[model samples]
Target: SEMMIMANWLMARFLSERNLPAIFRSQPDPKERLYNEDQGTLFQNWMQRRLLSRFVLSSRSERHSGLGLNAYLTATSPIRKYFDLVTQRQIRSAFDLDTPYTDREIERSLHSLEQPMFSVSRLQYQRKRYWLLKYLEERIGKKEEALVLNRRRNGYQVLLTEYLTECMLPVSSGVSMRSEDMIQVTIQHVNARKDTLSVYMA
Candidate 1:
């Protein structure tokens, strides 16, 4: 936890120092508050929009409602994120008094990047879930607990604390499960190849 906090603090400092337009990761819950009015009017509201987006790259604006920044872009890592590489090239060329790409080229890239990123995100999630399901498959019958994230009509969607994965719990105990409820549960069955899990409330 200390490492994470320090890493974020360092990144924020680095971005502020460069005065570069970079990507800012926002808070997950758009309605969640993180600050008091004493901090700033916008900061508190911005805290709520986290997890609502992936990487937001805008060469155009640095203002992230959540980051409370005047300008931002995503040029932090060239290899990890293609968007960062593109932004870095643009910044470097501008410093050398030149343009890196034509206006049409930039527009074309903007059009193509969305789908590729979305596909990659979906694949990454599926892959992780596949491995977790495999782990659960080996441990079936072990009693576990889950955090309620969403309540469905027939069941409830729960987040498994151990695996850090969410799956449906087949029983709801005849009540509307509230969010963040720590409900006792057990792993009934799991199929890794099929990427499926069957869970029940304890």
Candidate 2:
């Protein structure tokens, strides 16, 4: 993972320095820090993940806060990702080994990809959630351990330790809970297609 990050970082710098047009991945700083190491290593990591910002792809290079880099792009995983292949081609073009793409061309390509990429991402997320919910259905009514991640207006956002899935657990008026609290919960209902999972304090 480290090597991949380094390679992508270097490739991004190389393309930017040469004024090449390529898809650069950029991410802003996280919203806020919710936990410190003193709280608990696991809890801190989870909170950090929760606070992370979403990454975006563009023709212009920009800082990637998640990777703590001034600029970054993904040139690896060509077979697994279309943007990687496009970035690799840009690098090859830099070395006079392939055709070069103009900034306008890259921008148009990104625009064309937006819908397809969003659709694929949404499908993958829904499919994974469906399977996970199906797995949980078998354990409905069973007690499971959960970690409170955040307190919402009407409920608490919790991580189901056994499955690593997050769900909202509504509490009655006057009920109180704190972040990072570990509590037992009973899975009351689950619907994979509807993407609903109901749980309550056990």
TM-score of each: 0.66, 0.83
- For model 1, where is the 10-residue window of minimal lDDT? 42-51
Worst 10 residues of 2 by lDDT: 34-43
Residue by residue across 105-202, what tens digits does model 2's lDDT show?
Answer: 99998999988989999999888889999998899999999999899988999999878889999999888888889999999999887889999999
Superposed by TM-score, candidate 2 places the C-alpha of residue 137 at a distance from the truth, in angstroms, of 1.8
Each prediction's whole-model lDDT (CA): 0.62, 0.90
* lDDT winner: 2
Best by TM-score: 2
The residue-by-residue lDDT of candidate 1 on 10-69, one tens digit each, is: 554454465543333333233445565366432223323442444464333434555554
Model 1 regions lying over 4 Å from their true place: 1-56, 65-70, 172-179
